[model samples]
Target chain A: MAESMTFLDHFEIWLRAYLILSLFSFLYKDNRFYKLSEHVFAGLSAGYYVGLIWQTVIVQQLINPMFDEGEWVLIIPGMLGVLMFARLVPKWSWVSRVSLAFVIGNTAGIYLMNALHGLIFKQLYATMGSISNSNGFAGVLLALVVVVGVISTLVYFYFSKEHKGVVGVTAKVGIWFIMIAFGAHFGFTVMGRISLLIGRAEFLFYEWGGSLGQIF
Target chain B: MRNTLPVIIAFLAGIAMVISFFFNPERTVLGTFQENLLQWVTIVGGFTLVLGVFSIVRVNARAVSRRSDGWFYKLATVISVFAMAIPSIMPTSANSAFGKVFYSIFPISWAGAFGTGPDSIYDWLFNYVDSPMMETMFATLAFYIASAAYRAFRARSAEETLLLITACLVMLWRVPIGEALLRSIDVRIPDYINMFVMNGFNLSVQRGIIIGAALGMASMSLRILLGIERTYMGKG
Candidate 1:
């Protein structure tokens, strides 16, 4: 596979190898190589967004519809977008509020409905359904655990009343459930990070190292 | 006027979106209005990126001019930004007037196309430079996580002990070596861990948290719509 590579392919492999090494250098200690690669990464990522937004949002969504398709009403949003830059000017900074408010309000409206329907109701229905759907003895036990865990967790978060009597007991149980959940989450995150580490290691060892061996 | 007008605009925009959710798009203009509003928001949102790019350029340019400690790195960033952006914004087709001029002026035969397509400068930079760095950055976190686990994974209380046990079981279940070791003890142990600890306890707690969070989000959104959450509108 290394022998079959073209000049551009070789160059790409070598460049990627260099960047990966440069970034990994941070493990040893921060140096000029790492700093250079870090800055370059930031710039390229930001620039990538520039091209993406220009092509997708500005041209495709705004300009094309307004001019070619005769959807002139889009100018209102276009003007609103331009208003965002008013934040740069001191006296005229207040002018940007209209645009900010629109975006915020629109997002808030979407989130409110989504939260009520998508999250709260769905979760409640799933919790109730799990109980009925249990199969055997172990299934029933697990389903009971789920029911207890959820109720306790919610009781734990509820701070309206002081932690005494039944509320305190439920809250204590909630704390244990939360701790277990957090531990599981931590383990999951570690595995994910380790997988990413393995990926870079594989690329370095197989692609870059293999190429070097072929060359020598 | 500055304060009141924005609040009104927010209320109206929010109300329109909420109202649009109920009506069928096929039957009413509200559907069309909703679609337009979403598109408009996206277009408006894109400009924020422009603002971001401008800010990056301004700050880096100022630092470079002052010859700050890491000015050279800052300069590299600014150069990288332009190097990636300019070619991506250019026309890809060699037949086009701009592309003809650009290719002739630069004369890089290897670059078969332009814009954000394959074999372009932007794509090349993204593939080789940006992506590897991002992967390496994330990969580096594994080390920090190990150090953190060593410090924080102590079993001081019942809750902490439960956490440690759960974490240990999960970590064992995840890795191939650990799973094999567990299987050597009892083949069903790994499955039990998956069914009991993960599906039972983890799922339930997560659902409860989600419900709590959704309620919080709904309340916050209501506040924003009612013009009570003016904190988003920065102080004058």
Candidate 2:
């Protein structure tokens, strides 16, 4: 299967090997080689995105309206964007404030709705749904346990007074529940991290290493 | 007044995007607004990211000038950055031309290495290397899980003792051998306890954890959007 190679073929092969090997170097250490590759990776990605934006915003959105379609609606946000450039001016620094206000108000309004509908309503719905198929004493006990767990965990955040009565007992149990919960989560996270490492190891051992890498 | 405002804007826009998915589906304008805002924010983020490259250039330039132990790295970084960036910038590189030329050679070359052709290098890498690597990594979790159970399951106090008992029983119930052993213990106990009681309870607990994590992530994400936390912005 051996064949002669051209100059550009050798150049491409060397480049591919380099980029692959350098990326894998991070597994060994966050050394200079890895840093070099990381910087290249980051810069290339950033530059590409910027180019895409220039095409999308300038060419598609802005230019199409001003030149092609003769539409003016696109210029509203464009003017606001221009106001952002005023921060560099000596006296017109305040121009960006109005822009900032709109951004804040717009964001707050959206999230408040999400918090109410997505988080609160869905959770309550799911809680009820879990108990729907549950029957017999075990089902009842299980639902009771869930209700207690959710409520007590919420109560654990209450810090108005000395948790001396029922609140204290509930919070104590809540802490236990949370600790166990975290332990479970920690187990999963640990598994995820190690698996990612193994993936890098496999790349180094096999792919680039070729026939030799598969010996293991 | 400063970049801080934009940071806040970016943060809030992220929250808006998430929230829009929930209650604002009827508000088509709001969805469009969030999408537009994020695109603008992304453009701004691109500029900030350039500042990152500039900072790196400054730091590594100093390191190279001072003759650091691995100054060759800074040089390589600069070179590769330029190699990838300059091609996109100037657009006269043979690589780009090569892409254009070979673009028509393969039957389906657009998506990736595999899409290039059946006899492509990418197809071979995908089938023999990348896919296997991903699957192997995912599979490695089984062993790590077994190890974690062995090490973490220790009895010390009342809670610890209870945990140890549950953990061992659960572990035993999961494996086929464990199920066989449980079957020999008592047919009804294994069926009732292992299948119905333990399995059902564990599933519920996991579901609860997932829900809790999702909520926490959303709240944290919201806080970041509102500019309550500026951790993502870095030291600058």
Candidate 3:
């Protein structure tokens, strides 16, 4: 056992277990350690994203043009970025409006071109095919179930307020269909979450335990 | 006025966007419009970042002025944001640079490097750090569930007894023991008293729970959208 497992390996495993189990301790009651861990996690994540945006977008999109190839088109956005500083000043902050419009327009432009191809139109086209295209009998049933589930779910949100009478009854039934689907989905999610915890626990038990754990 | 105007603009922009998808307006025309809008989005988003950067500047400036502890962190953060943003377009690493500078970063295929550099740092963080943490956060529901079961699974009245019985069956069926104890773990209709009946019951029960959960989520989202729920905004 000692031969197979290094001391550092054991220490690291236990460290993860301690952090995870300590996080779980918040369930019993709020505590300082949980807060500390949560805060650390937040700060870490924020820094991480900013790093990514820097690497992926800012560097690729902005700085590369400035330094690397001297592509002046990139400088337009750069100038616009500088223009955004208008917000800092009292009278001239409205100068940022030009910048804001550029951002909105660009996003709308991209999404307008790309989003429908992947999401709505494409998805609808795929689902329009026969249910047999689904893998098995169960899969076909599941597809049908999903369609009905989605429709019913939508009905549950039919909040025009005036939607009552006969349609109201149908809407209520839709709500039930949606409710059942949601409940089943929740159970699945709960199982998934529990599975994650169990997986972590297994890591602690098997990985951290010793060479005996390695054998299995 | 600050928030309201943006919301209105977003709404109008969204409506045009919806039309653009189906219409497929002439490329030369739409492309120009789209290009113009893309530029606008980039600019506006950058300006928005100015608000963000200014806030960062304030804290750091205050810190530098007051000589506060950890002021250097604020300084580092500001400097890093700038460094990362500048030459952000530059080839800090091969993957980062898009144009010709990116093309010549190295002869070796980046795939060979596999797990290195800023991209890899992000990939690693997301996989190991973010995924596990998210899973861990999700896993925490087990404790709440257990406590709820303990208190809620009591059989005080007839209704309670019925509820307890169903919940117990559900709990059993959910675990490994239920299939083991019932005999013939495989599918069969041995008796209405036995396997088939229980399976049907369990399937329906699970299905119902799934639908309820989805509605719960939808209700919550709708509430937030309608301004009925504002906890996310921090203090209603």
DockQ of each: 0.79, 0.15, 0.16
Which regions of candidate 2 fall more than 4 Å away from where they truly are?
A1-105, A159-163, A201-206, A209-216, B1-80, B89-236
State TM-scores per candidate: 0.94, 0.57, 0.56
**Model 3 per-residue lDDT tens digits across residues A125-216:** 54444254666765566556545444444455657665588667656656555433333344454556668778877765665566346645
Task: Sort the predicted structures by DockQ, highest score first.
Answer: 1, 3, 2
The local lDDT score (0 to 100) that residue A93 gets in candidate 3 is 63
What is the lDDT ranking, best to worst? 1, 2, 3
Q: Chain B, TM-score, each prediction?
A: 0.89, 0.54, 0.40
Q: What is the Cα-based lDDT of residue B199 in candidate 2?
A: 39
Q: How far off is residue B188 in model 1, in Å? A: 2.1
Clash counts for all predictions: 0, 2, 46
What is the Cα-based lDDT of residue B8 in candidate 1? 93
Candidate with maximal DockQ: 1
Error (Å) of candidate 3 at residue B19 is 8.0
Mind giving the per-residue lDDT tens digits that candidate 2 earns over A1-216? 114455544444345456556555554566765566555554444434334444455545665566667866656666665565554454765665545444444554555556556666787676777577668897777676666666666666557766778999987776665554444444445546566656656654544455333323
Which residue pairs does candidate 2 place in steric collision? B11-B225, B12-B225
Error of 2 at A71 (Å): 5.2
DockQ winner, 1 or 2: 1
Model 1, position B121, has a per-residue lDDT of 81
- Candidate 3 ranges beyond 4 A from true positions: A1-15, A80-100, A105-154, A161-163, A211-216, B1-135, B148-236
